[model samples]
Target: MDRAPFHPGPPAEVTATPAGDRWTLRFVRDLRHPPERVWAALTDPARLREWAPFLADRDLSTPGDAVLTLVDGDAVVAQPATVRRAEPPRLLEYTWDEDLLRWELTRTADGTRLTLWHTVADRGLLPMVAAGWHLCVDVAERLLAGDPIGPIRGAEAIGFGWTELRDTYARRLGDA
Candidate 1:
């Protein structure tokens, strides 16, 4: 399949809300695939490596502690994370470093509605994180559409249209 050219464009609709001592960054995307398919991409390491920023030591469909290996340039940093919630194709929540990451999948008329809530304590990193996630989500959508475009990592991920996305999100978040 011929892949669509990657474009930074406008950032996805993201909302940052305060959650106690942290802020939750929420991203919603309507995928043209079923929850099962999307869930596989979200939980399976093989599928995740195709798009996600991190790789899991084990299948994330189970509730337990799993090692998360984040892609940083040529290096992979491993971290221990406990799965807070795992319910097949519907929900998955786990620890992302010191923060909590939650993914919710809902069946929609056209496809699946995927929502990601990432708890962030560093307010300064919001734009950067948001941009990185926007790119990751785009890559996942492309992969599910049968036009996988490989992985973007570390400096490349941040350099790959991140500044534009960050600027866009900053404006949207009114943090500029």
Candidate 2:
């Protein structure tokens, strides 16, 4: 799909570690809902299953932040993550492995603008991660609006510019 990921604030920066070999993909979407409503979909396990499912048949949402054990039948994937930043509905940040993700939401005239930044320790994994996030965030948007969810995610650009998009959000927020 040729859907656009919308945002209206200054985008945060995601960089490589001291290793200097990491890839990070960030997704932003201006949602049509309040911060409290948006927070519910993110923190709630049942609500998260509707969107943000990393594995096809696994529940990744658990309150109080701990090592997440994701098992689909036999195979299992353990992800170490925590709620790094939580401010009601303003921001929610966390870390999974060497990657850090932050979703910052701001109240707007129309709705809330949510920006997600995902840092990957492996550059090769960018494409898959980006595409999956696109789909999940779109689902999240639909969920926030009380609308039917759809499966739609765009392809990842091999070389998606970061600063340009970040600057765009920064400018828009300034104007807003």
Candidate 3:
């Protein structure tokens, strides 16, 4: 498999919707992989380590409770989360800290359409969160393509690509 050069771009489509005092950030991406494959990456801890910002202590394939450890450089913060919903190869949702993360997958003509909806309590952190998810999805694509890259997270992620992507998303989200 041939891998394309890394492109630091915002998501294909991202929307911020205000609901009450919180905001929901939705990221849409069409991945060139099957839903089953994508689902594995989303729930499998070993695969997540290749792309996600956190590692799970247990399999998230079923609806239940699990611990997620947020990884940043050499730092780790463990948080308990309940799998609010789980439908294999289609949907998975859970709570992250004070927020909720929902992943929806659909089979597309060429591959799969992955949509991530994250609810955040602090609207001020929208830019940072959006940028981090952008990088995460990008890494996920690479990992699924058989050309994985090292994780860029924690202070490294917030200070690195997060800076530029945050500015771009901030502008797009009208938060600038």
Candidate 4:
């Protein structure tokens, strides 16, 4: 018998809330892993490269200034970032370029519940962002489970059903 390939079904649960001039998209996902383990994947630079959309120059486990390089195909843009808060395996807040990302990990009976609050100035970008995170989270879970399908990001993400996910999110999230 052969195993079925991993295929992310749809976008995760996300809510867009108005925040003055910006919009905050809250994405919640339940991973079958402990908070401590999830925290390592979220903050470790080496681990992030395996599942994230960006590559961190250093570990994001501390509160301080850091650099995050976003890659799209051969285009790599290094963005200056600041880690505003880091609370071990619980909470983390940081900035990626002009966008602010806050992650909260709560321990659940099954595993860890990860909630991401991302604030972006462009409301039109919500669906796209949501789609990106959906793929990232799926990859992250696989990595945590020791299956490791590698990272799906940037232009390469389109090959992994990015368009469909984006469209689904756009419909679900509405005109934003």
Cα lDDT tens digits for candidate 4, 1-176: 11147688556899999999999999999999999999999999999999999999999999999999998878989999999999989999999999999999999999999999999999999999999999999999989988888888799888888889889888888967
- The order by descending TM-score is 4, 1, 3, 2
Top candidate by lDDT? 4
Per-prediction TM-score to the true structure, in the order listed:
0.92, 0.62, 0.92, 0.96
Scored by TM-score, the top model is 4
Residue-level lDDT tens digits of model 2 in 1-176: 22355331233333322235655555667778887788777766667655664322222233345554343335557777776677777777777656777777888888887777777776545545544554566667766666645333222221233334434433433311
lDDT of 1 by residue, 64-83 (tens): 99998899778989888899
Q: Which ten residues in a row have the lowest lDDT in candidate 4?
A: 1-10
| TM-score, structure 1 vs. true | 0.92
lDDT of 3 by residue, 1-176 (tens): 32345666545587889867899888788999999999999999889888888999988988888999999878899999888899999999999778899999999999999999889987767777889988888888888988887666778775446788888888878882
lDDT of 4 at 148: 89
RMSD of each: 1.9, 8.1, 2.5, 2.2
Query: Local distance difference test, per candidate?
Result: 0.84, 0.56, 0.84, 0.92
